[model samples]
Target: MTNLNPLVIAEIGKMANELIVTYGKYKETKEIEQTERIRIRATLLALTKKIEAETQTFQLFLEKRFEERHRLYDMAEDLMKHGMKEKDPDLINSAITLIKFTYCEDPLKGNSLLKITDTY
Candidate 1:
C-alpha cells in the first residue's frame, strides 16, 4: 500500500464521474441501445466500487503512519524528560534528533516537539 499513488486515485474518481455523466445523458435521451447503456452502468459500478476500496486503503495507510509518528514523538518526549531529570546530554541529544526528524518529515503538522526542540 506504500506504493499507492494519490494521483491514480484522483484519476479514477474523475473517470467515474465522467461515466456517471455519460450514463445520465444516455438515460435522458435514450439515444444509445439498451445493451450499451447496461454496459456503461456496469463499468460505472465497477469503478465506483474500486474507488471506494482504494479510498479505504488510503485512509488506513494514513492512520498507520500517524500512529507511528505519534509513537516516535512520545518516545522522544520520554527520553527528553528522563535526560533532563538525570542530567544526561546523550539522551537529550537523541531526543532532539528524533524531534527534528519528525518535524522535518511532516512540517505541516503541529507538533509539540517543535516547541520543545526550539529551546535547545
Candidate 2:
C-alpha cells in the first residue's frame, strides 16, 4: 500500500467505495429506506446552502452596520471640532446630539441595557 502509486491507490479507493454503496446496507433496511436516505442527503445539502447564504447575509449586515457606526462617529467628531474652533454653542449642541443619537440610540434596546457612556 505504501509503495503504490497515487493513481493506483485512488482507483482502489474508488472501487472500494463502489462496492460499499452496492453491497452495504448502511442504515437502509429496505428499498424505501434507501430512497429516504437519498432524500435526506438532498435535504441536508439544501439546508447547508441555505445556512451559507444566511451566514453571508449576516456578515454583510454586520459590515454595513460597522461602517455606518464609524461614519456617524467621524461626522460627530468633525462637527464637534468645528464647533469648538468657531466657539458656536449651536454647532457644539448639534455635535452632541449627533453623538447621542448615534451611540445612545441602542439598537438592541433594553434587551441589552449596556449603555454607551460619553466616550467620545
Q: Judged by lDDT against the true structure, how good is candidate 1?
A: 0.82
TM-score of 2: 0.62
> Model 1, which residues run further than 4 Å from truth?
1-32, 106-120
Candidate 2 error regions (>4 Å): 1-29, 106-120
Question: Which candidate ranks first by lDDT, i.e. highest?
Answer: 1
**Per-residue lDDT over 1-120 for candidate 2, one digit per residue giving the tens place of the 0 to 100 score:** 259898998999999998898776653567778799999999889878966986786666667777888899999999999999999999999999999998876544433213434332
Please, what is the TM-score per model? 0.60, 0.62
Candidate 1 per-residue C-alpha lDDT over 1-120 given as tens digits, one digit per residue, 9 for 90 to 100: 477698998999999999999999979678567778898899889878966986786677678778888999999999999999999999999999999998789633443322433221
Each candidate: RMSD to true structure?
24.3, 15.5
The TM-score obtained by model 1 is 0.60
